[model samples]
Structures are given as structure tokens and as C-alpha cells.
Target: MDREAKKEAFRKYLESSGVLDALTKVLVSLYEESDKPSAAVEFIKQKLGGPSLSEHEKLQAEKMDLQRKYDELLAAHRDACKELEELRNLKHEGDVKEMVDNNDAKEM
Candidate 1:
């Protein structure tokens, strides 16, 4: 679409989303400030609770948490596998010793 059409669509969106109202209020407050800010950008940022982390930052934090959990689970799985192997070896050794003892008894 043309630039005017895009602008109208964006304006409608901002109004519908209440962003226009919020921004207007913030701007009005800034205009009434006694100690006006040097930078409008900083004033807006401060008005809007300072700079906030975007969704990407939040997702990265969640990803790191999941990664940590996955690492822990993997380590637990390795330990369980090692324990299972040791148990199997012990059982095998016991079976072999029992078989040798039975053979000696039969010969006697």
C-alpha cells in the first residue's frame, strides 16, 4: 500500500491498542515538567519504567534455565547408567563364582 495508507493503518493500531493514549499522557506530563529533561528519549524511557528487556532476553533466560536442567538430567542419567553397569558386573561375577563352586562340589 501507499505511505498514507500505511500511516493510517498504524495510527488506527496505536489508537486501538491504547498506545496513543498512554504516549499522549506521557508527553503531556513531560511538557508540564518543571525540570525538563535534556533528552526526550530519556524522559520517555524514565516515564515508561526505564528500559526493559525484550522478549528475546526473557527467552534467553528461560533457555539457559532449561539448559541447566537438561545438563543436570544428563549427569543423573550417566550416573544411573554407571550404577546399572556395575550391578550387572557384580551379578555376573557372582554367577561365575557360584558355577565354579558347584563344579568343585560335584568333583568331590
Candidate 2:
């Protein structure tokens, strides 16, 4: 309910979830860097396992390309299935007609 209590609860949550440990390790790595990055926030972000903007963009492009290929393959599969069904129907009609003709010839 009070500010100190809230702070203690937040600290406990971070420790229990291992956020404190992970952040400490990342900070230690940044401290040990001989050539410190100009963008310290971005460096910390990357060290915290977040993707950089360029990597995120590249992934998005790759996802879009894969989706396009998937759509093309799906369309081709549907077209092939439709053609197969039409051929099956045509063959069935031909077989029925041939049987009827044979019956008529036998009757004659």
C-alpha cells in the first residue's frame, strides 16, 4: 500500500523472475567492453536479447517472401487438383458411354 512496500514487492518480483540477474550480467558485459558503444541504450537493448531494427526488418522481408511462395504453391496445388478432378469425371463418362454401346450391340 505504501511506497516502500511497493518498491519491496517490485524488487521481489524482479528477483523471482530472474530479471535482476539477467540485467546485472548484461551491465557487467557492457562495463567490460573495451570499446564502449556510442549508443549505450541500444547496446543494452541488444545485450538484453532484443532484436536490432535492421535484423527485425530483414526478418519481416524474409517472412513476406516465404508467405508469397506459400501462396503460389497453394494456388498451384489447387489448380492441379481441379484438373485431376475434371480428368476423372471425363474418364468416368467415357467408360459409361462405352458400356451402353456394348449393351446395345449385344441386344442387336
Candidate 3:
């Protein structure tokens, strides 16, 4: 079928949609007058990619930022684990008892 026939069929389909009556009228009018207003939303989204970051690009950036944050956190956690292991090895056997005794003396 031709573009006009397709536009007429779309108009018929859109008649059942009360929510989009104004949009349907506008698009149908445009479609009848010209070949425009027939492009689907996905087509427009695909066409508008990345002059200043489309929605998909923005989401990918956000995901990368989150992954970087997670990697930083993991690095910090590993450093903390290494430091904790070093502190454990450096601690004298009686150090905990000395601290407990000092705190008890302070309380008294």
C-alpha cells in the first residue's frame, strides 16, 4: 500500500484511542499534507543520538560512574584489609590486656 493508505489506516487505528485524539488529529493532518509525523518514537530516538548525550548515552555514563565508584570502594576495602592484617601482626600479645588495664584504672 501507499503512504496515504497507511496514514488512513493509522487514523482509523487511532480513532479508538481517546487519550491521543489531539495528537492523532495533528499527526493525521500532517501525514495527509506531508510525509512527516509518521516517524515512530523509537526512530526519532535513534536519530537523535549524542550531540550532547542522548538518554541511552546518559544512562551508560551513569553506569560507568557507578562502576568506577564501586572499584574505588573495593580498592579502599583492600587497603583497609591490608592495614588491618599489618596491625594484627604488629600488635604485641599483652597489648590488649594493657589497654584493658589502663581503661580499668581510669574508671577507678
Candidate 4:
């Protein structure tokens, strides 16, 4: 039933007074074992219960963070490629020195 009735029934049952709580207790204890008994499955089921939008929100937040990181890394990689192309086209010592300086700045 509800909380108060269930509690009173449990206490009375522990007091060895009646037989109504027998089926309920047995059913609760054996709930997961009727057809598909699994401790892991029950644990996961319990974890997913109870107003649980947080798990979905957490996954979305993680996806956003990963997307942001991916965009940053992609931009850095493209810039690195462009700099590498410029360095390849360098024609003199001064040009090589400038490219090396720019590369060092990028590393910093």
C-alpha cells in the first residue's frame, strides 16, 4: 500500500501477528528472480528509476564538451598544416628563421 500502512504492517509482521505481509515480502524478495534473475540487471534498473533526467543531461553535457574540444583541435591542426605549407615554401635563411619563430610562438 502506502508508506505508513506498509511500515505498520512490517512492524506487526515482525511482531509475528498476521500473515498478510507474507506474500508481499516474498514477492519483493523474489521480484527479479521470477523469470529473469540478474543482480546486475536489477541494480541497473534501480539506478535508472526515480525522476531520472540527470543521466540524459549528463550525456548531453559530455557530448557538448567533446564537440567543443574537437572543434578546437581541428582548428589548431588546420593552422599547423597551413604553417607547414608556408615553411615548405620558404626560400632563404631569413624566411626559415621567421617560420621557425612562428612555429615556436604557436607552441607557446
The Cα local distance difference test for each model comes to 0.90, 0.96, 0.71, 0.70
The CA-based lDDT of model 3 is what? 0.71
Q: Enumerate residue pairs that collide in model 3.
A: none
lDDT of 1 by residue, 1-108 (tens): 999999999999999999999899999999999998788887787677765346447888999999999999999999999999999999999999999999999999
Candidate 2 regions off by >4 Å?
none
Please rank every candidate by lDDT, starting with the best: 2, 1, 3, 4
lDDT digits (tens) for residues 7-106 of candidate 4: 9988887668534455455456566555645554444444434223466688889999999999999999999999988877775667889899999999
Report the C-alpha displacement of residue 18, candidate 1, in angstroms: 28
Q: Model 1: how far is 22 from its true place, Å?
A: 26
> Alpha-carbon error at 2 in model 3, in Å?
31
Clashes of each: 0, 0, 0, 0
TM-score to true structure, per model? 0.52, 0.89, 0.42, 0.39
- Lowest-sum lDDT 10-residue window in model 2: 47-56
Better of 2 and 4 by lDDT: 2
- What digit string (tens of lDDT, one per residue) describes model 3 on residues 1-108? 999999988877778765367565555655575445344554344443423236678888999999999999999999999999888866864697789999999999
